[model samples]
Target: MNRRDFLKLSGLTAASLALTTLRPRALQSPTRKLNFVILLADTMTAANLSLYGYPRRTTPHLERLAGRAIVYHSHYSGGNYTTPGTASLLTGSLPWTHRAINLGGLVRRQLADRNIFHLLGSNYHRVGFAQNLWADLFLRQFRADLDTHIPSPTFIHGQEKPLVSQFFKNDELGAYYALDDFLLSTHHVVNPTAGSASMGYLGLFYGLSNRDIGTADAEHPYGLPSNGYYFFKNSVLYDGICDTILDLHRRENPFFAYFHLMAPHSTYRPTRQFVDTLVEMEFPTKQFHPLGGRTNRRTLLEQRKVYDEYVANVDAEMGRLFDSLDAAGVLEDTYFIITSDHGEFFERGEYGHDTPLLYNPVIHIPLLVFAPGQSQRVDVHTPTSSADVLPTLLSLAGKDVPNGEGRPLPGLGGSEDGARPIFSVEAKQVSSFIPLSRTSISMVKGTKKLIHYRGYEKYPDAFELYDLQTDDEEKRDLYAEDTVTAERMKEELFDHLADAEKTLKK
Candidate 1:
């Protein structure tokens, strides 16, 4: 039986009347105030994008847009995964301070009031939505500051699933994980959207309906392929985003629209044209460390090939979005920022971004700003953190950066704090309120970097150093080779951690 039919038999559906409403508020005069729109694409690593000099032509559309936008080459996510990375962007605080270190953790209650939405206040209509349930958690935490919150499922532009899911409110918790992957993952029949909890009985039906999509040799025949529980295609998601932007233009003047899209992530759903075009499909012959994860070279190459294709597909969708905004004349008055929550890794025996490793593939990301009235393109080679995004947006809106760890972007009335060590943390095993009891961290200053991995049962507490200017891939360990640099960076890393821990007491 299909998942929907199984759900009917199991009686797991709940009929709740409440539904999300995206109605426009009272129409007000367009007072020529600048609007801000953040296009947050989840799991889009910069290492794979052709815009960042990858061998594959993965991002031709973004290459076109980057000409007019301010692009940062060395931008890094605050955390290796969603919880910590998205929290850093919203809270303007690092993983240690915001403490979204756990898998599904939220920002600290004390610093919760200091988010971008709250800091922006009522001066503009603060709108927030994310297709990623993990990122949506942070938005829900900061919901008090939002003027309107469009639902994530609304991003699906075309026909939704069975009619029953529409009327009944789905169990959101069910969407968090799927039982289908237990047996069906290797065979692969159920698409990612099949896990959504919003459809109530329909969600359970999705759980029940893992159809026979043929063997692993045959890719998706009818349903979309999926790696995680979330099911959203970038093309449809981008269509909804374009529609959202134009709709907000019609709303009250000066709106802060934060649309976090789930695209270019896992399950690598690239269109036909983008698939298998690249020459190299085999994994690298790099020395095998046999560390944390189980992915081999062949698996890495397979995952990366599709991931690049999916990234290219998303880039094309972005091109359409830009065209729509330009046609509406909203681009002239809107501050558009394109970035990702975190990156994925294909190296170091890892397939996806679930590992605790903070390698360059997992942390390095793309950051671009198409500020209003920015006629000429600018590039910032200096290193920056995702934590700076909130303050940079604040600065663009003519507001102060607040007393947070982030500084504004260089082009937008901010300077590169290269002297101040930038930090990245991964603390999936620890609680949000407790800081630094068990965590993985990276400290970046100038060309030197130091990474600390602690509390992992597989990996002991250790410090690894790398010269980013020389080793961008972080394959070489410079800890023993460069003692002077390592010691200095270690001191800075611990000091920053100490400061972050002190915030907990306050």
Candidate 2:
């Protein structure tokens, strides 16, 4: 069985009834206030988008949208996966500080209050929704500050599986860990059963009953796009998002909405129209890493092709969402920010971001800010991190920027600082409470990148350096060849890590 079937069979098919709701009201909004809308597309890496000079025209809609937006060319995620990457965006801190390093982890309790929703204060109406259950955990964590927390399964087909977070709304984070992650665990890498014999038997019958629901249709040749637990149509999802925006517009207050979608993530299910219609090209074959499984190059390329088509399908839906919102005048007074939590990978004998490798394909995500009334496109070539988003949004809301690892993004409330060191961490194996003993840290300053792998049996304390300006593919290892730059960057990286470790003592 595939990942989706396995997850469903792990007893994630429980019935959920209760949902959080808010009263609908109508009043005139403040004339001078600006609404902020963050449209987060999960696993949307810049490595495959045409807007970022990728050979494939997978993101034609984004390319058109970029004409009236601010595009950052070298934006990186805080981590290689959803938990840490999303936590960094919400808290304006790196993985080391927030410590949401594990697969189903949450930020440190002490620093939990320092989130975007809480930082935005009570002035703006906050609405949050996420199809990605891991990303939705953060929304649940910050639900106290949210005026509206849309259910995770909003606007999907009726037969789709409901989230455990929805079932135990009062204790979503705890319930997810207890019921989903522990008792009914089906993550192949993490836990197959974990002694959940009863639930496994129950889920077997449930999966058998719902097996027909996953069959392909004429519209969807492969199958409906799924978030591992449920299937959903992109058209329906975008429609719901548009309707939510319109409803939010009717309210009296300016709003801050974060809609994290799970399209183009995995199960690479593109609509029939998008299948086999994009660019046909080849990527450079690179040396395989011990951490990256031994998936053949042919299989990787085939997976990449399907993934590109899925991305294109999502982009088309985005185009439709933009059109509908623009027609309703929602785009006129809203600062729409488009980005992703982390990225996907189909290289180096790997097919996804599950591997510990922190290469560009898994960490380099797209960042585009469509400011209110923006007419021309502006490009920022300087490298930026996901941590910058929280502080940047606070600045846009006229709030004081908090002291954190991130600064206001350039051209928003701050100027470009080329020397600023941006970092992405991969530490799923590390504990949230202790020091990062096992991690992969990638530091990028200017056009140079240094990747440090620690606590791996295959490669202990290894470092790989590359000048991104000269070798974007990272084929050349400059660590031994360029000792001066390597030593300088190594010192800075270790010093930063040392400082971050001091927090565990407190």
- Per-residue C-alpha lDDT of model 1 across residues 1-506, encoded as one tens digit per residue: 76534642232121010000100111122355778898988899998888887878888988888877777877889999889999999989898898888866778888889899999879888898876667876776776788876655564423222322112224332223333222122223334343334544454555446422211323332245332443445566677778878888987668999888777777667666666766674444545443457677777887888888788878888888997898788887788889998999888678789877787778888998876655545666667889888887787666777898888765565755558777889888787766666778988887788988887665677888998776777778899999998888888887778887887878
Q: Where's the lowest-lDDT run of ten residues in candidate 2?
A: 15-24
lDDT of each: 0.72, 0.84
The digit string of per-residue lDDT tens for model 2 on 377-475 reads: 677777889999999888777788889899888777666677989999999987788888889999999889999999999999999999987789998
Give the poorly placed runs of model 2, Cα more than 4 Å off: 1-31, 158-165, 185-189, 194-196
- Model 1 shows how many backbone clashes? 9
The residue pairs found clashing in candidate 2 are none
Model 2: lDDT equals: 0.84
Question: Where does the lowest 10-residue lDDT sum fall in candidate 1?
Answer: 15-24
Give residue 128's lDDT in candidate 2 (0 to 100): 96
